[model samples]
Target chain A: MAVRADDIPVPRGRPRLAGRVREWLDQESILGPVFVTPALLLLVLLVAYPFLMALYFAMSNAFIGRPSEFIGIRNFVRLWDSDAFRQTFQNAFVFTGIAVAFKLVFGICLALLLNEQLWFKRFIRGAVLLPWVIPTALSTLGWWWMFNSLYSVVNWTGIAVGFMDPPGPNWLGQKYYAMTAVVTVNVWRGLPFFAITILAGLVAIPRELYEAAEADGAGPVARFWLITLPLLKPVLAIVVLFSTIFTFSDFNIVYVLTRGGPINSTHLFATLSRVVGIDTGRIGEGAAISLYLFPLLVFVVWAQLRFVRKQAY
Target chain B: MEPIRRRRFLTTAAGGLAGILATRVPPARGQQREVSYLCWNNFAPASDKKLAEIGQRFTRDTGIKLKIDHVSHMGPQQAKYASEVQTQAGHDLVEMRMHFPWLYEPQLVDVSDVVGELEKKYGKAISSAYEGAHVNGVWRAVPQYHGMFVATYREDLFKKASLKVPDTWEDLYTVGKELKKMGNPVGIPISQNYDSISTAGPVLWSFGGMEVDKDGKTVRINSPATAQTIEWYKKMFRDCMEPEVLSWSDASNNESIQQGKAGWIHNPVSAYIVAKQRKLVTADGINHHRSLGGPQGRHETDTPRHIGIWKFSKNVEPAKEWIRYLLGKREVYDEYIMSGDAFNLPVYDKLQDHPVLRTDPKYAALRGEGVQYHTYGWPAPPSDKVQLITNTYLLPNMLAKAVTGTSTKDAIAWAEIEMRKILAG
Candidate 1:
């Protein structure tokens, strides 16, 4: 008996092969994974591979062009004994903490101001983003020149304003000043990311809530504390979490401006890792130095995510 | 229809696979030869242009292609060299300076044949060249030229201060103190800069301090001599240097002198050359002198340049030929030197009197200055450990710590510990 065209199983031909794939991909379970495969593969290749390699290198006595042998935790033990490494750890925390705190406060203030009615609002918003948009290395070079001991523009300006004496404060000469200078640059570069992201979240908040709060006789500060902040918690949490990680691993601002100079006062994890791994050819130790912050960052991210989820409930 | 579709699918899949496989196969080549070089940007732009022109000439003379890649002479270039060594595939010839030849010796091709040929034509290579390029009875690299730290000073300021050109480290301290009082401070970088190491080398050696013994087996950094050197540095830093020296970069000293803020700076002639070229400082205002003598004797640090062919290079023969062509001919070498405004010095004794060195009165003192030049490791053969110490700026860090308030004993002790760890590794 002859079958109709639709009665057969499409003959299992090449065209049917494509149809079967489409049918499989259309299923919810398969579709989710199929859609995510590209990103998953990318993460595996770019992130997971390098991370595993770093882990391997950290546990071994590795150098370029040389065979490596497993040395276990000796690198970490040696680093723990090093004063320089200890200083680096302290610096990473101080740099990231101070920078992120200031960035949050300033970002919120800037975002609030931008949210208000003002002349040239578009122009101001765009101009405020210039520091963030410019390449970090290039901008750090500019900062380096401005902080030059002899040709420091900051000193010249200070002198011109009659606020500073002949030799203005050596912005990066002293350890404290170097830390402050690096932190200042980090805040300057990072503030815009916080502001822009917060601004986006602010815009996303419903207008009805503020009106309702105003109807209940809530003042501006109270409304912000009660409504705006509660609503912005998720965005702020994510922003701070990411900024903390980025700032902790910061290298360019420190490397270009001071190169962990003035006795390594401003060395972040990345710069110290570079000094050990690439410069000194102690790949194992360098890898260990870089991984020092990974655990802390993971804990921070995990805590932030859990906090955000609880807030949602 | 089903059979036809199946056939098409199989054919397409096979074709795709074949195409991918074909891409993996390298194309056949004839006798054509090509080589690439990675080098730092020259002190003089014209020198780079001249090098490029010479590359073109080589391509014309011999039916081979030459490509030159220039990178900034800073951390990135070092990273690039490390990456290249790790991969074992990159530019055929790499321009190495200071401790790199020793650092990458295992991966470098022995260029003894080229060195021998050049030595036959010219006289023996300079001591700095031998110290830097030759290691373990093998000429791992061909020494090109070395940049020495000469005392580039403002003549008018010295005369006004009644301070004769400093001949000794003591003179520098006294003169620098006087000059500092006169508002023109001496700019000896005390930071983690290459110049800091260069400046410290003379002081450390002149005080008879050594980082490692000549055998490259023992650490000799912590000693009475080292403490003495640190004491001198502390005094100089307190009296002559502004606190800003603690944060200065490699280019800071040059800028300080060119901007007329410094009375004296121990740097290569590039600063003076740039000042004259840019009319930032007059020719009469600037002069060059020998680096100050220490208690033992006058010694200067040499930033020696070397040309090394990678062992993995496919065109090692062509790369060596190009290096020989550049260094072997006196006229070619002289032209290159002139292009650099006498910035590049001759490594061979025969080329020492090249007219480029004598034509300029300011550069007169720089002639044969390589005689007193010493590499970073000084007494020790520059081993991998020595290179690590130099690259990590251990000496500068120790001096910086001492000058910035860490006690001399503590600084030296710390450095000795660091040195021991590196040597042990």
Candidate 2:
């Protein structure tokens, strides 16, 4: 037998295993797949699988722990007849619309304010994120106490300041007030995300643009309207898109605060889905309720991304 | 030594893997036997502690290691059950409340044998327990204990105002008015919560209202009886309770009475038990009254809890052993019940007069004399449809709508349509 390198026996240990792994990874195709396999597995297990399961469940009469039959679009169609579902559908739009609008406006103002050379800028910036950083469920519990009918600090303060009647508004009890309270908490918790992200966008705006505008005799308002607003469009569009989806799907604030209560006025699709699916064991209906907005949301994402691309390029 | 080729190595590895797969057992089969039980954090905290202590004793005596986990009673517990059932995995045993056995019938192990042994040793399980766990003529769970809703009121406040304890739902309105005027409103939650349904169920049943007929198909929410229930709630909402009742959770009523804010609340004895346990200032002042009656009959909401073994559990025998150890033994069962401070009462007919009731004179109302206790959606079996009606909160929402300005007729119509839709679906 001619001496062959292949006939040589290497050490039977980690080095051999490591050598095999290194050899496999050295190939471009193998390396690409090896790197992607984990993320692909994760997406399949965590996201894609659940999403497809939800889609199937939405089309079937899937009760928890029970045999189910395919019911086609009946679940989706039947959901329309429910007053609660109707209210939830309307509430999702209202909640997302109002919350995103407020977050955008307030986020911009706060970002501008933070962009200034204020004292303790770093501390102020960090403090602004407190609402967003704290666990939503835990923080919402605090807001629940403040909005509690029996012991409302907001009511107490309002009374102390002689700003309202003796008894303050039933923040989480009545329909309109409960919606306002939930929207208010959503805005509070979400403002920091908008502020920080917009601030990054604000910072990325070259100082030269403002200086040139100023030199052109443009007032501060004019400069902002002409330069800053146009430049921030992409960031704002992306932010608004994410915020809209998030607000529509918000669960904790409504669940911990009002539980979509006072006649389901504050119910978002997420809470309604929970009530229908897990609480009631109508997993099919719950899935339908949650996925009801999927088409609309997809449109929103596509439209906003298109807007962003337009601005970016 | 011969050098191993990749093909030979893969062949041997594949053979070993196939052997393991065919056997359907882990390669390391020397692990100790263990059983895990998932229960809710009992309203009486001491009961949870007692459960853990008993679990340790179970391990020591049976040599089967036991693990216990508790989630919150209502929403979280239900969510946990759904997740477990959907995944076909989790703890081997679960504590089921009310109609959960019906909802999770397919997933639960048939424990008729265990329940039969328990019934022979103790007595027949209470009607509520039977209704809850006896699914489709099979015992899906072993009846553990029950906590019936009672009228928890401030005795001191009633004495101060010289107000008569409410005997009926109508009488409650009268006293409720005085209670509100005294700045301590009656706290019967009418929101999207089980407590809301708990109170609403009794009130509706008393007024001869049934959400669904006994057949469990007809939507009877539009009946005159239901309208009467809604009207009563509207006035009660206007004159007696605060707008806060419209936003209360299961714990809100408990907290209201415990904190001396509400003069009265409809809840289990857990409210007073917690107050007494915590030595709150209002503990001594709080007392229980029998559940109020309605025009149809005296009906109350009973929350019966049971222990169930999952069908998917490999350690079924060990799981059953834990239940037998916890509830099968008389002394152990009594000790466990006593630890609840009357919040968790024995569900057996023989133990109805459990000494835990005598633990405090305040618990006397838990006796629920002559008050027919049923779970939510009574008159109709706790089928999945009835449960859907209950969970959808049609009852509370109807009352909420009526109280919030929607016409009683309109609200009742809305609820009827919703109920019929669910039943038809």
lDDT of 1 by residue, B111-173 (tens): 999999888887888887899889889999998887777889999888876788888888888
Model 1, A59-177: lDDT tens digits are: 99887667889999888888876667888999998999899999999999999899999899999999999999999999999998888887789999999999999889888878898
Off by over 4 Å in 2: A1-37, B1-32
Name the weakest run of 10 consecutive residues (lDDT summed) in model 1 chain B: B23-32
What's each prediction's TM-score? Answer: 0.93, 0.93
DockQ of each: 0.53, 0.69
TM-score of model 2 relative to the true fold?
Answer: 0.93
lDDT of 2 at B165: 91
Error of 1 at B81 (Å): 1.4
Q: Top model by lDDT, which number?
A: 2
Position A178, candidate 2: lDDT: 91
Once model 2 is optimally superposed onto the true structure by TM-score, how far is the C-alpha of residue A167 displaced, in angstroms?
1.4
The value of fnat for model 1 is: 0.58
- Score chain A of model 1 by TM-score against the reference chain A: 0.93
Error of 2 at A85 (Å): 0.8
